[model samples]
Target: MKTYFPYQLKYVGVLFVFIAIVLSCIGNVDEFMRGLLAGRNDFETSILNEEATKVDQTLAYQPYFSEKEKDNYLKISLILSLSGFILYLFSKEKSEDEFYQQLRAKCLTQALLVTWLFTGLIYWIRPTYQLNGFYILQLHLIFFTIIYVYNKKWKFGTE
Candidate 1:
């Protein structure tokens, strides 16, 4: 298949993935802070005390607190990372050719097979663990990218 995006799009993909990672970090930290706060109920059982949630007002609870914001960060980050992954997948190398196309196809197939095996192992070891289809696809995409990058154009830049 013909590449739809220019090599420059890889930069955009990198940016998106970076942003997604940052957002995910922020979300996890927020959840952790909330848990820590919630756990510090002082010498009482009530959590409505000012000392519980007055930690300089975290990024997630600024201005007002809403339950919706708790989950939105995760969803937004996932969407952004997925978008970035797709852009990077379709973007062309500076020197794309038939050989590169065949290599890409082979890498993707290998990634899929490896992902399936990994998923199966995970399930077999931890039957309680659950993975969604989207997560599986995301894992496959990551495997494909890593394989393709190392195989085709891994380099230590001096610039």
Candidate 2:
């Protein structure tokens, strides 16, 4: 069995996550720059001061890849975060042994089962609420980490 992510990519994954975090916090790139120059949050100030016009308010409703691209940034950040997380999770460990591979497979299977169950329960409880790709990915990552930690700590701790 081969590892899809090289051990060195662990550092890259961390960098990607950091970048994603920064991206997620950023509201509008143009506005952030303006805020930096003005030494304040330009968007909020504009709206609060009644300086934001109808056109400025309509910026968020623009096309995804349009000039502003407010929501696009958030979507990109989410995708980068998920990709980085998976890369980090599956990256080769120091040992890279058969036991580790088997454990990874087992943990992933258990994670998938648990994520599906959780998703079903959430929908059963709230039928009108919709789950997005990022939400599902987060659940998958959460369950995978939990299962992986449990297996490593309890099932094979003595080994």
Candidate 3:
């Protein structure tokens, strides 16, 4: 079996990550900007409100985003993030060597172990409440982070 994935897969993974971040940030940045400027300077209030109203009218009806819309965004973000992480994890390293292959295997094992432990704890501790899809998405994020960290650490050693 091939030990290393194509280097290009890493770039594709990064692109997915970027797209996911942008998708997730759009609503948040809109809200933040509105909040930050909403009460500032009485003169700008009218302009801001007018602009906000116009923008709201032009955009889809989900101002605060309905539950369905939020769920859709969350699902898309999760898929993109998971894809990116998997690609990043498997992509070839700069130097594809036996040690690197061993490190990759170890990182995958460690991440899987940690992910399952956290998943079990979440399931056992908060059964119903933790059943939200976001929690599973978060678990995947944690798993990815674990793999990334261990890979980085082992690749560079303790320097």
State the displacement of the C-alpha of residue 89, model 2, in Å, after optimal TM-score superposition: 1.6
Residue-wise C-alpha lDDT for candidate 3, range 6-124, written one tens digit per residue: 97898998888788777777635546655655444344545677576554444433257655776678679777877887677778777777776777676667776887788889778
Per-model TM values vs. the true structure:
0.74, 0.64, 0.61
- List candidate 2 stretches off by more than 4 Å: 27-68, 153-155
What lDDT does each candidate get? 0.77, 0.75, 0.67
Q: What is the per-residue lDDT of model 1 for residues 43-150, given as tens digits with 9 covering 90 to 100?
A: 333544565354334323432224577468878988888889989988988778887788788888989999999999999999999998878988888998898887
Winner of 1 and 3 under TM-score = 1
| Residue 54 CA displacement from its true place in model 2, Å | 22
Evaluated against the true structure, the overall lDDT of model 2 is 0.75
- Runs of candidate 1 exceeding 4 Å displacement: 34-67, 154-159
Pairs that collide in candidate 3 are none
| Per-residue lDDT over 29-78 for candidate 2, one digit per residue giving the tens place of the 0 to 100 score | 66565545454435556656665554345444322244457677888888
Name the regions of candidate 3 deviating beyond 4 angstroms. Answer: 1-4, 27-62, 132-138, 154-159
